[model samples]
Target: MLYLVGLGLADEKDITLRGLETVKKCSKVYMEAYTSLLSFGLSSTGKSALENLYGKSIIVADREMVEEKADDILSEAQSSDVAFLVVGDSFGATTHTDLVVRAKKLGVDVKVVHNASVMNAIGVCGLQLYRYGETISIPFFTETWRPDSFYEKIRRNRTLGLHTLCLLDIRVKEPSLESLCRGKREYEPPRYMTINTAIEQLLEIEQNRGESAYSEDTTCVGLARVGSEDQVIVAGSMKQLLTIDFGPPLHCLVIVGDVHPVEKEMLEFYTFGKSSNQIS
Candidate 1:
């Protein structure tokens, strides 16, 4: 049997009881490392912590292993129980869905164990989940490539008075372009986008588009290290949030749309100089 288990959002201890049981029973366990990450990150120390708790050695599966060599993992599951762990919920990223499809094509039985992800955890800031429109991902903007396709989506959501959740990009084990052309793979250092950088990029895009989808003075929420003990949530204008230090990786941004009375009351707790700012 092949099991795709979610490790939740914060740390190794965040794994659900069912996921822990499945991990303990599996002969081989692989942790998917590209999509998202826990508070402990992908360091050797973090891996060892998880291994100690699960009582099984885990193979860290990078993008190449998962995307190029997935068949080997599925083949192993064909005869023995194998566990594939994900940072958030099993289906948070589309890649996991593809994995399940491939496993099924190979006639491998699969089971999914679900857990909380940033998709829902953002509610801690008091924004109603139902009020959010299509979520968008903000990728790192290079000098030659600065895509603004997500601008239209955010514009539409704002027009309808719905909030927009912007998931920051995470680049891990990415091969350098020059090295790829040289026929020898050379990986660049991992990068996790910060809320400040995301806002700066958004403002630049808006400046170029001149559509006014959002502005520096627009009300927004910056979240960092969410679901962890040191999680920080600050509610303010984009300009104000830019000056504040979020102090960690795995940050996300929320552009407020139509604020209902109840949401306003809840958001008051997180507004600048309020009690929620003292949470961490």
Candidate 2:
């Protein structure tokens, strides 16, 4: 049996009871490391933390192993119990969906254990989940390849008076262009996009597109280290948010479209000001 388990958002202890059970029962357990991450990330200590809890050795599966060499994992699942762990809900990223598809094609039994992810956790801000439109991801901008495809999605969501969630980019173990040119794979250090960079890139894109999908004065919520004990959430205009520093990695941004009375009230609690700089 192949079990895809969610480790929630914060730490190793965030694994659900059922997920832990599945992990304990599996012969091999692999954590997907490229998507979202827990507080300690995939460091040796973090892996050991999960090991201590589940009492099973954990394997950190990088992008290459999961994407290019998924066959080995799938083949292992064909005969023995295997647990594939993800930081957020199992289905938070589309890559996990593809894994399920491949497993099913191979006639492997699959089970999914769900947990909290950014999609639902953002409700802490009081925005009605039902009022949200299609979520969009903002990738890091390159000088030669500045992509603004998500701008249209945000615009459409705003037009319908629905909120838009902007998932920031996380580049992990990415091969540098120079190494690729030399036909050798040399990975650059992992980088997580801060709310500040996302806003700057958004503004740059808007300048090129000449459209008002969003503006500097547009209201947004910046989240840093979400689900962690030191999680920080600040609500303010894009201009204000860009000036502030949302410490650490694994940040996400929310673009407000039409704020409800309750949402506005909740947002007022974390609104940008002297008090917001302090930890919540």
Tens digits of per-residue lDDT, candidate 1, 77-131, equal: 9999999999978998888999999999999999999999999989888899999
Judged by lDDT, which candidate is best? 1
Whole-model lDDT per candidate: 0.90, 0.87
Estimate the TM-score of every prediction.
0.97, 0.96
Q: List the residue pairs that clash in candidate 1.
A: none
Model 2 worst lDDT window (10 residues): 271-280
Worst 10 residues of 1 by lDDT: 271-280
Off by over 4 Å in 2: 274-280
Clashes (N, CA, C under 3 Å) per candidate: 0, 0
Candidate 2 lDDT tens digits, 1-280: 8899999888888888889888999999999989975345567888888899988798888878898877889999999999999998999888999999999998998999999998998887768899899998999988788888888998899899888989999888899999999999999888889999999999988788877888999898888877878888888999999888888788889999798899888888878984344344
